[model samples]
Target chain A: MSECCGTTATIEAPVEPRVAGRIRTVALVGPPNSGKSTLFNRLTGLRQKVANYPGVTVEQRVGRLNGIGRGDLTLIDLPGIYGLDSYSEDARVAVDVLHGEMPGTPAPDAILLVLDSLQLRRQLMLAAPVLNLGLPTLVLLNMSDLMEARGGRVDTLALAQELGVPVAKISATRGAGLDAITHFLNRKAEAEKPVPAEGRIELPVMGNPRSYRQWATGISTRTKYKAPLSNEWTKRIDGVLLHRIWGPLIFLVVVFAVFQVVFSIGQPLSDAFGEVLNAGGGRIGALLGHGWVESLLIDGVWRGVASVLVFLPQILLLFLFIGVLEDSGYLARAALIADRVMRSIGLNGKAFIPLLSAYACAVPAIMATRTIENKRDRFATILVAPFMTCSARLPIYMLMIAAFIPNTPLLGDFFGLRAAVMLSLYVLGFVAALGTAWLLKSSILKASSAPFILELPQYRLPTVRSLSLRLVDRGKVFLRQAGTVILAVTIVLWILSHIPFHADLAGSVIGRLGQLVEPVIKPLGFNWKIGIGLLTSVLAREVIVGTLGTLYGADPATQSLGLQAALRHDLTLGGAMALVVFFAFAMQCTSTIAIVRRETNSWRWPAVQFAYMSVLAYVAALATNQAILHFVH
Target chain B: MVAIALLSDFGVEEADELDLSGAWKLRQLSELPIGTVGVVESLDLPGEIQHHLMHMGFMPEARVMVVRRAPAGDPTVYSIDGFEVALRRDTAGAIRVREYEGQNTRQG
Candidate 1:
């Protein structure tokens, strides 16, 4: 039994006439797990636009209230945050947007403060500071359906009286009680008189969490709030899922299943996609037959764009799984389980999801680092993500292993040499990532103390609409990158290789540049043609195979041989092994570099990452080649 | 105060051993067994972490139940104010709590 403090007396006067103006922009603010995003999707449907805030990686999502009968009313979904205190980047962004301090974002004329009714006693702590902002505020108790079903109770009329604002208990998931929002907006838009602030309860001291909690507890008691019982299924599931013995084992199984789906199923889908694109490009090329325009359009732009687009299936598959894990709240449990292992490497448990996703593509994985709250930990994770041996490295590894390693059985026909080499390459990338993370944590990016505070939200079934929206958004990001940066790089490479028009492959500008760098790579057992492959592979790690195929096809001496035969004839055992090793460690994907730059909001990080990884790759490959040569001699 | 006099009669002399209400003994949150509830007394952590934990419903007088330990047993989950949150052993050790004596086992 605590009494309301004295701060709310300042707002006891009638709401100013300007405050009742038509609500053009509404901001949705709430803590994590409050179902704020779900309500946003419900109100806006398919009309949301997601972008980053000015000069920050935090996402700024704004959409129109199409379902609320006011298609012109804009709703800005600020990042979910615990408090307005700016300890993290997300909270800072939310604070800026609410106060109209952020550039390129209109000031929210009203605020929709959504809280979980089941946890209103705790969540109501946010209402005090927010109400102090003096914007026309509506407190939306989301998840009220689940709350009531679990025996929770709340007196919305009494609560609204206490806070001096409208309170609506609605379930965003069930689409129940949503007409309250429309009614509120319509009434506010038509009303022009001053709103009398009667029955205004006192607020706690600003920025003091203890006083806020006491104030919240007093309000809850007065409102007769009854919190729901803990979900029985969540407890039972955690008893097994977080068990000492079963938890880690199940985590392994889940991770294995994710990768198996992404590769075993997604690979065939991607291959089919690639084939379809190639066939379509060929048909278009035949219409404009035999000219530089055909070559540029078909071989340069079409092939490059198609190769990047082919990854859409695998990226979507990875995101589908990520979306499910995230929406169902299993991602938090996974982070808790992974905290120990990740902490040993100087990263947080939340880093595990992004690192796990890096095996598919670093672009999405880097984007996934937004879940990490600490800026240092997020940056460290982003810098090391590209070393996780993504799918792009598979083609080069497969080609080299096929040309070099024999299929000799190592252990009674169970494991072959080729499989051993491939596994070793995977191991190499993981080790490099771990070692680099350790180095960074010990030196430049060291935090004063590691603070990992994660809330384990109650599990729920993921919605199909939410998952599909996630996939659509991810597909858009991947395609936009391919159409811009990848397309530009492809056009530039095409022009350089065809300089002095119709020149032989050896006499082109790119070939001369490759020969110019031949002396540097000779120590690693690479020829000038391999140097050219290295240069082209900077566009994408998988592009090396196509570059080698084209370069060797253009040579009269090796034209009669198959691509694999030509590679085997030109490269020694040491060089072939070194080539795969180089691909294993190098940061060769421009997509990853571009994403890293965008995520870090500076080129310094990607530049440093590229340089460090390249040096390491060169040194490792040199050791690999010289050691094999010495042993052979 | 009554419990303090009763404890004094049993030869316990340290006033610091009891919380302000003298109904329960004060201990670090990590020392509490699973299923046992405690009222948070104070936080001895750094400023940012302390604020964050408080924002997460770890304020003074808030009842928190030790739910379960992670698989490796370093971080433990605690239920506070109708929600569950996980904290590492070091962080939990900084939170001072008094063993709760209320009959409502599930209510926070």
Candidate 2:
């Protein structure tokens, strides 16, 4: 009975007739680690759009199916879920979208269910619920290449009969056997006949996982599906990677290498990018001939944009390393290694990834918290993520350390006083994050207990296409920030500084506001100039470097000196130390604040977060400045 | 000691059973040594977590093997239904498993 109809005819005959343009949306759904994302990337290439679902942080990724010569078709990649039961927010959104009940998303006309063939017995459990939805579905057995290599066997024709759906074997990573997808869609295009009642398979009791599992097991047995032999490499690798001693030792080394690369390689690349932007701005400014328009466009707009844009290299590099770690399955191992430490701080091991990535930038790091299933744990992670000392804090820390700290050797030639201070600042930020997480977890956001259930995926080599796509996505997000919030803030600062049409630097509107703020920061040993930097840095943490550069450049006494020399001449040792300390603890970046608002979906959390961090920063800076002053005297 | 108590309790429940040779023992999943194989008997966790574990192929009668443990030795990895899942000791303690004699039980 299963072999009576050919695969092509069976798939084409069931799709319900809709108007030509109405058959536009197709949903791609699968359980986690089923190669669903790899398939999505293969199908969509560069035409994907990522956004959040209405009023929630769950990402909605839709792309044009142009790779298969179907530009008219849209593929909506739903979140990877175990079942359609609404136990989590991800499941709820997936359920809503599939039922066409989601507010803004179009209901999918068909479904592409990707399941890992190596684990087909367990994965087949999902097929029952999805097939019951009555949408035209194509069951794609992804990783079929690996399955075959490992001596796993599956009779697709028989399996298709058991599920009453079309089943195709394809390796998403290898980009092989994808023509079946195009064929299915092409037939779906010309499919005008209504689905026959006899085509439906007898599904298990809905919403019961035990019944689903039993039903799935029976199907696999009848279809003669053989489970693949466990991959030997994975077991051998885990022996060393998860060893009692060697695992943690290797994890530390990997983390240290990532930061070292970000500073050693990424910094020089950023400096070169900065120089190019500067030279381009110079040429454009010379064309305008030293007028207010030139200053507004070059110094005000271009400089501000360029300052933030220069960090793109470091950000992309960090994201590249993170993407590789994630794709190759090493990140999950790292999380496992870090689980005990995280649990002590009232967070799950999954929270470790976001906090680790927070060292790059807090925006994406906050977005990464969506993987943490517990709401309180997720929120607590987000609240402390910005304290991890992002790359944006590097410029101010370097400037302060270079000006204030002498190059005295601390550990022979291997470590010096300056390096020690830099390391201490990093440690300080991490300690603050841990402490804050503990407080939040123990206080209002406390839960009964958050369970940690992590699935460790088989290790695979990271693909070049996937890594490049990740870098491109991250680069786009960073550039968008530079173009929008940072650009607007720069333009506004320029306008304020030039309000009287030709006012002196000290007498401008922003300058007056800086003087007004000086009294509040006086206890922390900061002057009006540092006051201005602090105010502008609320828009972006690194803008302080640019603000200070402009302020000191306008001062005739320090105009000839480099920024480090000018900073040394103007600031006391205590004030300079206090400045970096303030940055280390404060939530200053507008981008971080905006992302927090979007992620938490309320102003209350970000508002409380900002106020608490600012208070902590103020007290810490005051204590640092006053202690240094007293000790020196 | 706790494993023995749990085994005796299960023995009372299966009093009518024919396999009275003491070849099978009931224990928490966490008590199983690395490379040991067992069948899931029940999950005593809370509602949401139990449902989630079941969805991840931890239903009763499924075969699960202890694969490895993390470096810090808290979350142990178990192979169930052709995939590896790591559960902390506390979560693992909530799962009851039936370990039969002559099964794979390699000592670590």
Candidate 3:
């Protein structure tokens, strides 16, 4: 809908010629670990959200400027990157947009070059090339909150004068520094001004064409930090955190513990929701008097969407863990540890941020890959990004692992064992990703691995405001997406299963369809119950369980629960394993398919991804059930 | 053993007159070739070289350059691809090479 408001620049390679405007747009740029997003959040509020540019899966966040007193300004947050010389998809998009190469993407009237207060000199290296463009630039001194806490301060005015730019000191978290930015924005004169050729600095100092030292000196002079080199406390923390071994170990333990807690805490709430929905459905069905009205009340809409909604607790849990890790500054360290194995020669070490994000959701992760400068690495990374198991897959994994893996306690059996199964599924996704990468590197994507050239930013306490706003933005997208496409698919599936089967016809056409498919599914030990479950799952994989609940007499009292006992009573072991295999390979979620289409800019990849996944699901299910029947039966 | 240590972002042309032997430890340059590095052997082209040098990270402090030149030198490539770039033969002449270690025969 925002597209209707204006012709926005495509995030892929924005070459938006500046259209005539009473006001100019300003975009902030900085290195990947530069806290650019944190500052952007500070500037934009919850109005900022992520979207992919048409045809490219690149994630870009743009928000209307409200704080600068001029709601007329639009503040675009280009992906966080280390330099203009891109090595990944994110940096490439930033380069394209910075140059206004991406069509429909407007070049900023001016650039707000944000340098991390702790990592000023290095952050300026990224701002250097942008300054060369000669736009009226403002250098934002972010992370001032940390400076005070760490026993230091920066000389903002001196730094600004030295850089020949206005410098504002603000903690995007605490909401300081808006006055300086607003004063700059209110001036109409600076917006229309053209940058001199000297100010339009050319790409500098690769073969030593003289501009490198000049850029470095420009930053050195413009940037002043009151802290003595290597603050003692920071060094002490880094001694353990940046340690060769213990740091990574601590990080893994922390992440693993998060998953355990999520499963334990969220399971009961899931049950409550399931029970309430069923009770409501029963009341509605009884009041409607048992015809199409009864079917509609109990089966059609409620059952369809309910199945996927059951996964909400799981989805919310996943998002919470991700939010905490990112907000805690631990994710950055995770990236650092993963870097040695992940990054190769010829690529900047900074590309780690996006790759780590893939685990949460590939949509943003793929967009994040834009930070890499090398075309070869960028292209290769994009091509293989989908293989990383995103959080959406969590629901399907939880169901399959629960249904298939027996839950007798281990480790003196104190805690539930479902958590361990969940961890293994995560491990499987990771192994699958690595194997796929190895294959691509050897075959289609023969691009040599680039080395890690990166600036490991000093860690700081994350702001609650920024993290909460980000979580809100992400949560909104999940809900909106579910309410639309997932909602529709759930409706059609509900209809399909309600038509007619036996005398009373409590089950529908979908039930009949499942009966028809049972011959083929029998090898997987599926009865019509399993058949109906499979058909409904195609709407959204987790719907398989919810649909079964409705058909087998869902008691509103038993909502949001693992129907493991029920399924065990009704189906064989082979059938459960078959269901797991089916989900693992089926292209079940319509939302994901839609995202795939949006990301690839073509229907081809989504179609292919779906077909391959579906066929694999069927084959894996058949084999698992057939093998289990051959022995266990 | 002596060598010419010239810091350049983009590597030079294959045929050049300078000493490019022994190891070079690359520090940083702005814009170098995407995934390769080379040894610089001369000082020339102050204009074109500067743009690529700063972009690739051929900093004054680092040593990185061509480890070896291949037989047929059209897509002439350097071996080291890193933050501190190593320019190949074509790029080396543009950089003012110095001797940090061992310098070999200067074949023009």
Top candidate (lDDT): 1
> Cα deviation of A73 in candidate 2 (Å)?
0.9
- Candidate 2 per-residue lDDT, tens place, B47-71, comes to 7788889989887766688988888
Give the range where candidate 1 chain A is weakest over 10 consecutive residues by summed lDDT: A1-10
Show the colliding residue pairs in model 2.
none
Better by lDDT, candidate 3 or 1? 1
Docking category of candidate 2: acceptable
What candidate 1 gets wrong by more than 4 Å, as runs, is A1-19, A194-199, B1-23, B100-108
Regions more than 4 Å wrong, model 2: A1-22, A198-200, A367-375, A408-414, A556-569, A598-603, B1-22, B105-108
Q: Report how far off residue A115 is in candidate 1 (Å).
A: 0.7
Q: Order the candidates by DockQ, highest first — what do you get?
A: 2, 1, 3
Model 3 lDDT per residue over A515-593, tens place: 8898988887788777877777666655665667666565343334547656666678788777765665566766666
Q: How many angstroms is residue A542 displaced in model 2 relative to the true structure, after the best TM-score fit?
A: 2.8
Best by DockQ: 2
Q: How many angstroms is residue A599 displaced in model 3 relative to the true structure, after the best TM-score fit?
A: 5.2
Error at A540, model 1, angstroms: 0.8
Cα lDDT tens digits, model 1, A275-394, are 999999999999999999999999999998888888889999999999999999889999999999999999999999999999988988998898898888999999899999899999
